[model samples]
Target: MASAPPAGQGQQGAAAAASPLAPSEMYRNYNFLLRLDSTEVRFTECLGLGMRIEPIRYRESGVGNVVRALPGPVAYAEVVLRYGLATTPDLWNWLKRTAEGAVVRRNVTISQLDNDGATPRINWNLYGAWPCQWSGVPFDALGREAAIEELRLAFDRLDRA
Candidate 1:
């Protein structure tokens, strides 16, 4: 009493299965790599590696309703990195030098990894990034969480490379 699938439906499914555009479970967020300057920064969490392009609007001289919008320069957001407090003195030393009026700026690279955590699927390159703020781990007598250190960086430019 059941009817067969429509013509080309099975072929369509097969084609989709063979196409690269088909969705897979390859992409994941847990596996990522972070590098600052030539040294790798170990972080348990990272965020705000993104940019937004502002739009320029052009209005007609005589017409009051029509407005054309054009793309403007892109603006990048600051990045924040969080890691477990440790004996790492390299990052702290660099930050201290910046606080001492050196204003050390370095390039950073964040790479999104595949499910295996080996292959890099995408990369975000940040230029002229300097640590603007650093936060020490909070101490509490009753808290059980691990001590966390946070660093906030401001970069002049960001690109996908």
Candidate 2:
């Protein structure tokens, strides 16, 4: 049985709608990938700063590192940071200061070989850890450029506080 079409619609319009596989000029455009929120995310500091604001994102894996040490392992790591430092020490300081509230990297101690016994066991003790690391290189490199813009806003809020 044939169904009646709209009062003013033409046969061509109906034919276009009926064809599922037909290519059409109408399509969704998705050029931009990043979805950002400007809303302030807050954190409380240990030094009685009360609230620290931050913008957060679940960034890609390459942004951080997971390094295994020799002889089984000495320490494991996950570092996140912004890109803007001349040396490791400087970046380390920035990480310590900026991300103290958001991240941590605990240091694990490995015992050295002693003359007393060739057992040469690792101490495997827990040392202090830094929660945040400078976001690693390839992570920053491979990710969309929009990341820098988002990260800058987040860090700026951190600095203002």
Predicted structure with the largest lDDT when compared to the true one: 1
Model 1 per-residue lDDT tens digits across residues 123-150:
9999999999999999999999999999
What TM-score goes with each of the models? 0.81, 0.18
lDDT of 2 by residue, 1-161 (tens): 98887877679778877988555333322111111132212111111111322434354568555543333322233212233323335335535565656543333232323334233333333234343323443456566643320112111111110
Q: List the residue pairs that clash in candidate 1.
A: none
CA deviation > 4 Å runs, candidate 2 = 1-87, 90-100, 116-119, 131-161
**Number of clashing pairs per prediction, in order:** 0, 13
| CA-only RMSD, every prediction | 4.3, 23.6
Stretches off by above 4 angstroms in model 1 are 1-25
